[model samples]
Target: MSDSSFSGFVQSFKKLAVDTLSIREGSDPEATIEGIKKDMTFKGHAAWILIFSILIASIGLNSNSPAVIIGAMLISPLMGPILGIGTAIGIHDVDMMRRALKNIAIAVVISLVTSTLYFSISPITIEQSEILARTKPTILDVFVAMFGGFSGIIAGSRKEKSNVIPGVAIATALMPPLCTAGFGLATGTYKFFFGAFYLFFINSVFITLSTYIVVKYLRFPIKKFIDRSKYRRYRSLLIIFLTIIVMPSGVIFMNMIQETRFKIAVDNFINDNTVFQGSELLTQKIVYTDTLSTIDLYYMGKNIDENKIIFLNEMLARYGLNAKAGEYFPLTKKTLVRIHQEDGSGADIDKKFAEYSNDLHSKLLRDIYTKNDEVIRDKDLKIKLLEKRIYNLNASKKDPYPVQQLNKELKFQYPEVEKYAITSIQLQEFEGDSLKVIKHPVLLVKLSDTVTDEQRPEYLGKIEKWIRIRLNDPKLKVYKF
Candidate 1:
């Protein structure tokens, strides 16, 4: 193609891109700033709204209801003061900044008081998953807050506002974390309180930062200008404050990543090496920590020998879980392996079987069963077979006949009988043209010389009846010696 035609095509594409991406068209900066200022006051209606929203958010978190939490976020007046702070910073308006800060503090106090009261008096003390989720702030949450703030400010600056504000409110999730902090305070779980409060702080700061960026990009008119020296000082302080806020989240994200990798490695190790000749891995627990990690394996059917455990521990180095002596690497933290064996005893087997059966009946297992019904069925079959084998082995180890008890009872009933023995004997019989072997319970009794021959047959018949009744075996035989 000729240079002139190529240049024309490039210009056309650039024009289209600019037109599609531009935020300047139909912008209302003055109106947006005024709206933010108007919403910065925490008055009669706003204060009540904040209190009610906090209560709603707390209830939603306690109930573990995502939809309800989203609803509370949509109705919350929290974004107003936050947005006001950002706008004030953008325009260098000291008075507006003061008002925004004051209103935000009021909102925070009201939220905490309302949520704490509700959670304290409410009978539900359990920390639901929804509440627990907000207790940690990660780098991903920072991105969510920043992007949500950008969308919110851009949407607010438009001549025709859409539903972006409510969506942004849900995305940023400003209210739930505060409510979770209140829950922590009420429940006396300080870890939850600090973690949740830090999360809330992160969201607020990142949202404010994003708003300031967008406001500057949109070139909102400055209300006042400070001296250059004061500006530099404020900038330095802001950088330091942001660093403090963000460093912890960055560390948390790194830890989360490391934990995820460790779990994956552990899963691979378990799947590959957990199998033994006669043992079944019933359950496993993996605990990951910075200092030391641990893997606890629970086995059923047979006990894993010490040699195998030592070998498995040696294999930990392949998974990057075992550290060399004097090593100080982060991922090289030493992991301890503990193997708990059930030995397939009757009581232990029964307990583990009951636990597995209960798990199969649970809602989570039902959902998983829907996806892997065949695999679960196969596992169930294996468990049943193992249980049967264990039961059979246990039966063999136990005495089938209680000779001591039977001898005592016989001696008490018949004073002439000195002692007795019982056992299972195989007898051969001819049935038509085939020889068959049948097993039967046999009882042998030795009588005192005081008993004459005449009393022998009579005592033998009575003893046979008594033995049949006592042992509940109709096919038992009795003899006297």
Candidate 2:
């Protein structure tokens, strides 16, 4: 390529860069300031809008609805005062700064108050995941707030209004934290109040700082205040705020890292120090929130003091989880076993073995005895039930049926027969005065009132034969009633 052609290409790229990067070119600072002031005034319509937006956000958080939260963010007037504060600080406008601070205070108080009232009245008391998520602020929130503030001012300075402001509101998420803080207030869970409020504070402060930086970068004309010492306090207050907000956020981030590291260390310790080869590590419960960290491991065939206990103490120190020498060993008792170990002090081991063996033997004997008793009881119950069944069968056989299904069938077949009954008889007699009896099952049937009167004897004979055939006893007896 020719040098002239290369220079022309470079110039074209530079022009593109300048055109893309220039924010002040199309921006009117005075118009932007007036627009922000109009937005920053929190009274009448703005106050009502803020109040309603807070309620919507509270409902969203309570119901775990992300879409509702986004709607609330879009309608929220919170970004107005926050951006106003940022702009005021950026341009060194003391009057605007005072107004911005006052308006922001009003918005915050109203937001917190409105949300608190709504949450208190709401029937859904359980903390939803959406609300719970906002309670824990991370470093990511810092970036969101800063970027949102920066973009907000850039968009505000433009000649044509865009969707960027609403997008920033949703991205910064000012409403959710306030609603979450309200939840904490309603439920008496002060941690939620502190954590969520801190998140909101972080978003607001960083956003204001970003606006200040952007305005300063744009080199907009600064407002000269009449009282220098009074305005100086504002700068001092900003510094104080930076210390307060940044310190806690940094501390929380560090604690989160520590907690995560503690979990990994615990997991590694368990995986590496399984008591024996074929032993399974079932589950572990580790609490590392407070100064004293605890780990409870559930497993079988693992000896505590040999490797586990000593190793756990070492891990706590290695991972900075605050392990004590003798007091804070991981496991105190075996998870699934009750027997004492034979730790090879000859006599002591023997004594422990003896006790464990005796206990095992006693338990085995008790179980065997209990099982035997159950089996015996079951057999007795079965015998009683069987005897009762036999008695019922005998009784049923001897007595005639009170309402006979067979008689109904017979009556249907032979409608001339008015009534019918059959009783089982044991055919028995004394043989040659020997006082002994022989017996056979014979069905004795009685019939009465034939419908045709002309066939009584004939019907009786037919019925007797039918009864004998049906009973499977040719020796069945027939009688008239």
Candidate 3:
């Protein structure tokens, strides 16, 4: 061979070798993985799987069913594209990476759109614990995705792999977040969208990277690969583009870490200083008001002490936080105390009533005063008439009429009465414009004996007005006979 021809031949051989290696390196492992993915026939299987999983997840979130949620996670088919992207990147196979990313994006958009469609018409609101839980991603979620991807790649590459795909699916939790994204989309909850989409983004990036690492480690080659200088430049540009795209996500990941830490600090402060020691704090919410800070902590019970407040204030001072702390005990519990006075008579009615009234007013939101200017005692009085055993006389309606609805307005009419227990309500059926009648026959209103019979009509008049307003009929009458 001539010198020129020999040199050309050597160059050609080198190019061939590189091309062969690129093709093998880029195409081999993915070929194996892709074969399995392809074997998943049943047209639109992925679409169907995604659709079903989202439905289950949405229902689970609405119903607060953890087991159903886990099942949905297992059935989700989202990891296939995510891992594909990672493998493509690691092996430096631009084409494969593009395909993988496309698939991933398509799957996500489909899942989210499907979920949004389902939730939009499902008649369920986005108020469940699981829905709220996934709406906020912590650093812990990133860690989970990273580990899950690492494990997923390992399992996907193995022959006769033990249900690792399912394990990976559960660990990565791709579906739940997408379902939550749907919830956010439908409910117009921007926070939910922010957190859930961040989580999905984290999983996509870390999983693809992990898959790349695994594919490289496996030495999978791209088949029929052709490398050109122009392609190299293009590849570099794509890498730079992807990096730029992900830069903002890194910022979000950092913010999530900081926010999580702040919440932990607040909880710790509440637990260490509050009277609710060893109690499970139900909810700890921090709100930044326009001019002040508000920290609302709801506990399981209503056990508070004054000393705890002082201690909490000190903690807030240390953090340079000025906030108001409010505690609500169980609705059933009353802190109001009533005092009674006997005016050389039966039960020191004046003095006792004055003490009780003062305690109630102090604990309640409003103050209570009487025209007589006499102090009233605080007592939970249940009228015997309200608790009377009355039978249902009218068979027109069901077993019992709405007694609670009937008596809600009783509060304003009978401020002197602390509580009323409805013993029975008489329902009468009429053929004319009268729909129904509710009679509270034996209501023994609790009042001081000092209250004259003439004053009784005023309270009764208020009760009558309340009933008239609730019935929405001016002619509807209550016969106290």
Q: How much lDDT does each candidate structure score? A: 0.83, 0.72, 0.60
- Which is better, 2 or 3, measured by TM-score? 2
| Candidate maximizing lDDT | 1
Residue 183, candidate 3: C-alpha displacement in angstroms: 1.4
Local accuracy of candidate 1 as per-residue lDDT tens digits, 36-59: 998778899888888888888888
Candidate order by TM-score, highest to lowest?
1, 2, 3
**lDDT value, candidate 3, whole model:** 0.60
Prediction RMSDs, each to the true structure = 20.7, 23.7, 18.6
Name the Cα RMSD for model 1. Answer: 20.7
Residue range 1-481, candidate 3, lDDT tens digits: 9999999999999999988654333334654567534532223877788788888988887777989999998888777767766655555566766676667667777878988887776645636667767765655666788788877777666544458879888888888888888888888887898778877777777776667666766777654355698668866996786566466666656655544554455556565654444333333445432244456554433344455655666566444343234523111111111112112222332444555664533223112222111211111111122122222223213434455444545554555655443334577878698767765433334554555678767765665576556655454443332
197-272: candidate 2 lDDT, tens digit per residue: 9999999999999888888777767886447797688779978978877887787777777677666766666566
Give model 1's TM-score versus the native structure.
0.72
TM-score of 2: 0.59
The weakest ten consecutive residues by lDDT in model 2 span: 330-339
Candidate ranking (lDDT, best to worst): 1, 2, 3
Which number leads on TM-score? 1
lDDT for 201 (candidate 1): 87
